[model samples]
Target: MRVMVASLAAVLLASPALAADPVQGRWITEEKDAVITIAPCGAKLCGRLSKFLVAPPQGIDQRDVNNKDASKRSRKLLGMPVLTGFVENGDEWRGTIYDPKSGKTYRSILQRKGSNQLTVKGCLGPFCQTQTWRKAG
Candidate 1:
């Protein structure tokens, strides 16, 4: 009886640690255009731009800019943080996403849709857009 009780206690204690840190890896957007690697940043999680499968899509223009600074034109946004301040919530994580193209930040949430898929949503009040991301090898 004592051995059974101790074994059960150990299992219960280990469950949370085994829950899996879903965001602890690299994820690629469904478009397969870019990949972001997420890892522990202090006590929170942060995502850094890992790769650009190709040049930024044509016809896409920068949104917020003074249009006068020469240095801005030379900025390399490939390794910028697209996700930050994310806290684990069950199978999902909630945080803020910065869009370097627009120079804007939005409230974002990421939820695991599968073993290797995540649904990312960025919103301003009631308006929102969702994109699917897959775990990258």
Candidate 2:
């Protein structure tokens, strides 16, 4: 009985770590405009734009000209860390998401759907927009 109890305790203690974070991979945004790679950053998870599938809009700077911080305005959009400060919340993750298009930051939640789909939500007050992303090869 003692051995069985100890084995059960060990398994329960190790299960969370054994279940890897499903967001730790490349994902194609719902708009199919870009791919972002999610990975561990310190104790939290963050995502960065890794590739652009479509050509950037013409007649506009390819830089982060709309960023609130003037110094960051010159930074390139590609390879930018748009998702940050995410912490695990049960099966989902809560964080902040940056929209370079609008140069705004909003409360975000990311949840995995099956093994290949991820739902990304950004909320401003009672208004929230959801985008579903697919696993990228």
lDDT of 2 by residue, 19-119 (tens): 33568899999999889999999999999988888767742237888899999998888889999999888778999999998999999999988889999
lDDT of model number 1: 0.76
* Candidate 2 collision pairs: none
Model 2 TM-score, 2 decimals: 0.82
lDDT at residue 51 of model 1 (Cα atoms): 82
Q: Pick the candidate with the highest TM-score.
A: 2
Cα displacement (Å) at residue 1, model 2? 18
Scored against the true structure, residue 101 in model 1 reaches a CA lDDT of 58
